[model samples]
Target: MDAFICAGMMIIGRGISRGCIGARTTCLPGWAGVASSRRRNRHRVESSARRPFGKRLERFGVEQGMALIKDEAVVLRRLDFSESSQVLAVFTRAHGQQRVIAKGVKRATRQRASVGIDLLERGDIVFSQRPGGEERLSPLTEWRQLDHYPHLRADLARYYAGLYAGEAVAMLTEAHDPHVGLFDGLRKYLADLSSDEPGLLLARFLWLLLTEIGLQPELSVCTSCRRLVTEDRVLYFSSRSGGAICRDCEPASIEKFQLSVGATKITRGGPTDARGVRAALTMLDYHITEILGRPLRAARSMHATVVKSVSGGG
Candidate 1:
């Protein structure tokens, strides 16, 4: 009889566990809902448990197990998740772009050891990846800031440029696809934003970004005729055609931007000219906008920076 009773209890207990996992409020006649004793209002836990299995698992960070992932990352953006937690979008040197949950990060008594989770900040982070988890949001366990880039925040134009670069990386690059070269290049670009020729640097970085993404414009040859784009005369850049075009191949129906010989020469790493930089900026702006299907918010700021640089030089 004792063995029979124990077997019945075991069966009943498993039924309750399955009911809880399934997120049902009631489980048959004799079973009570699982409740959290720590909370004054038990409805919170009860209601939370009533959600779908996937959602409940994500909320509790429960899964098969945790896999440790340690990498150097550059902070891209952060969103407030709960009262005490934050969701961070970061570009890791080894893991590319990812979303991480920083729990208790906003608490006043939280421990901090050189981990600044601010936009455009670089940091070394330790996180835990949940196997067979919902939403795939990893939990950030530790962070040690590498670079704060205080100079960028001090200057508005520089800050906007940095924002642009970070946004581009977050938007263009695929998540979890490691691009260490692009990550390193962005770090160097941010460090050099305070240089004397920032516009030129930005233009060059934009060109590099295009090249890294395999969307490099054909500056050496015409896109249509495949003929060499000689530096003898003026050139026409067509967004629709994807690159420079000769006069014969240039479509009259499609609008194209005229590029002076100096501008064309600069694309091939010639000496930098203000006109060349501006022209390069224009062409890249068009190309990127075409590919992205939307204009970059920093384009206006970039144009303003160019005007200021030109006027300041004069």
Candidate 2:
């Protein structure tokens, strides 16, 4: 009789474990019911573990995961990481600035020699990153070169101008912040560098970049006193005060430099002559240097190249 009762209890427990007991049916008494409930929970955990990682996260209400992104980009800087890899700072049109590591990009095979990435090269790029990992370097999966701007390499002046532009973009723009207009302007500037005069092209580009980033100084009014500045007035530019200053306001500014009427007019979108353009670039570069807290490494060399070109022309 005891054996018969134990067999019946075992069968009931198995039925309960399989969820065969409906709401209308009575649950097993005490420890048998508890054991069945524990088995169900364990089974659920094992089932969950079998699902994909992304789905498992979704079950807990987490939606973000590793994502792959594609965009058009220009290489601003490149650093060799290993014999077969490189770290690149690339400015993308839609995605803004990104620091990514290109693995095996420099690896040599029987097929092709490893040339690696070059600064100022434009290309389409595909990279992978995790959500909330913007501060970390992304992994670059693929790259297809589009434009080498061959003219930039042929002329030393154009090459330095390109370098200066790359440095400015890298230093001034924020990571992951999109500047579509600025990107277009940069592309145009690079394209025009071969035929256009480097100095004038660089000046226009710097002005556009400054305007895009909201760093362009106040040109028409005194930044200190908010007074209207006229063409004849003795004008001073103070990067610290945020723009042009009148004579009276200039004394109050600790950091300032006198500006020529032509340079001032050119900076405000007026007509640009060759002499005025050079002066404009000088003033703009001054402001850029002040903002960066140091001089651009390429600035001196680029200026020298421009001056030499001009002197040779004369």
Candidate 3:
């Protein structure tokens, strides 16, 4: 009887040991499950945090053949395609100047809502850089509307000035040279000129634009004899070598245009009054016409003429 009881006690202990081992094996998977759930929960929270900017980007998504990119651009000009899409010349803050095509953008519904922006309009844009191509004028994928310079379109003089502005940008900048600051200066100049004084504004604009682009004569000094341009002589402007040559040196280079002594004193980035400005402008216009090889007919017609009051010549 004693032996039987001892054997039973040993068997019961062994069974209890086996049961405990089995219970632990089963609960281990549950522990692993809890750990995995914790890891997944952490991942879920991180993923949730990442969603907004992604949604912002999706709203900003641009379609290319196999990729998408983000960019900010201002509309410089746009051309209508046969009818369905538009080709745009945009100055992207990121990519300088680019010629992009907004595919299927011209339909009445406008897959992209706005038919590329009107000239000189500002906007947020997205476009693709193709797999194989030079960065110059990267193919435009699309233009998302952000803002418009309605004043540029609504007013007549502003429209023409806007065109001249476009000419300035195209002429002065290469396709991919980023000039954010110069453009900001141009934009402010445009906005002021559009609303304030269109007449006097254009002249000042030409002077500013030419000087900014490094096309005008270095008003720093007379190009000829390297003398400080004094305020006393009639000035002759040169388009050939590109600045004023004091009269003494005028005979040497191919003669270009004449500026009154007073005009020479008005340096680049300097001030001028109506009379001084007009004389200076006439000389500047002559230089521009000569250098461009033909007349900027628009500029010619835009001249501020002193009207001989219907009765007689002034």
Candidate 4:
């Protein structure tokens, strides 16, 4: 009894010796039970904290054993990364703009059915991104070519136009936000670039992109006063006002381009000759430059390749 008291192992009132509930007894299981209760409480709090995000993760298509994401993407730019890898900036149909590092795609021995992740190629890509909210580069595991525009690659004019489209899409769209219609429009435009008039096609592409993003100018009316534009007097294409302005609504302080009668008719989807097409292209370019805050690099190249060719041929 003295040894038990010295050991401080005996309960004074809760239990007696020899496992009876009375004074001068020891009980070890009660101590273990208190520790177990603390552990259980801690686990419950942690599990509750994780429940919401876990459900969201499931909604984002994270399966039980898989973390891969799949999407169709158009390659806009490619950069060499080590000896056997390449990093790509692509506009995806499902994920918008994404930067994915394609591992081992640069190696000569890596065989796949795709066009090898070159610039301006549309393909299916499977990738796994990092878990955090910050922008992290993902690993591209598989690539299979879907639409390869060989003609655009072969022609410098068409290639630059396609690059301009890709750049606009990448710059205007937000990451991981799907824009299916825009993706389809770009795919169709690139496909038709080789056979169509390159200058007109590019101008149309810019128009489509601007319209889809809600930035296209008010073509049939005065942007300043919302008046229906008519061929009544000399009109001005106002870059500052974002549309054609009637004579009364034109501001003296703002610089404006004179709208040809033909250009005015073209805005209403009327019959347009070659001159009207040029005028429309010029108006669209000014508006696009206003939105982008700078001239496109490909636009300069296209001036020589597509614009000059159209002018020279006409």
Residue pairs clashing, model 4 = 15-22, 16-22
- Where's the lowest-lDDT run of ten residues in candidate 3? 1-10
**Per-residue CA lDDT of candidate 3, range 68-112, in tens?**
445666676678864655677877665678877654444432111
> Per-residue CA lDDT of candidate 4, range 1-314, in tens?
10011001122112122223223222222222212232445564345335653342333223233346778888877788866667888888877888877654544321112223578888777766655632777766456567778888788878887887787777777777767888888888889986987767767777777777877777688888888877667788877677788888786628677886556544354324566556666677667777778876676776667665554334
Q: In model 1, which regions exceed 4 Å deviation?
A: 1-64, 110-116, 132-135, 252-255, 310-314
Task: Point out the higher-scoring one by TM-score: 2 or 4.
Answer: 2
Best by lDDT: 2
Model 1, 129: alpha-carbon shift in Å?
Answer: 1.7
Candidate 4 stretches greater than 4 Å from native: 1-66, 110-116, 231-233, 253-255, 260-272, 311-314
TM-score of each: 0.72, 0.76, 0.65, 0.70
The RMSD of every model to the true structure, in order and in angstroms, is: 12.7, 18.4, 21.5, 20.2
Cα lDDT for residue 269, candidate 2: 63
The residue-by-residue lDDT of candidate 2 on 77-128, one tens digit each, is 9999988778999999999999998766676434345677789988877776
TM-score of 1: 0.72
C-alpha RMSD of candidate 1: 12.7
Of the two candidates 1 and 3, the one with more favorable lDDT, higher being better, is: 1
Local error of candidate 3 at residue 67 (angstroms): 6.7
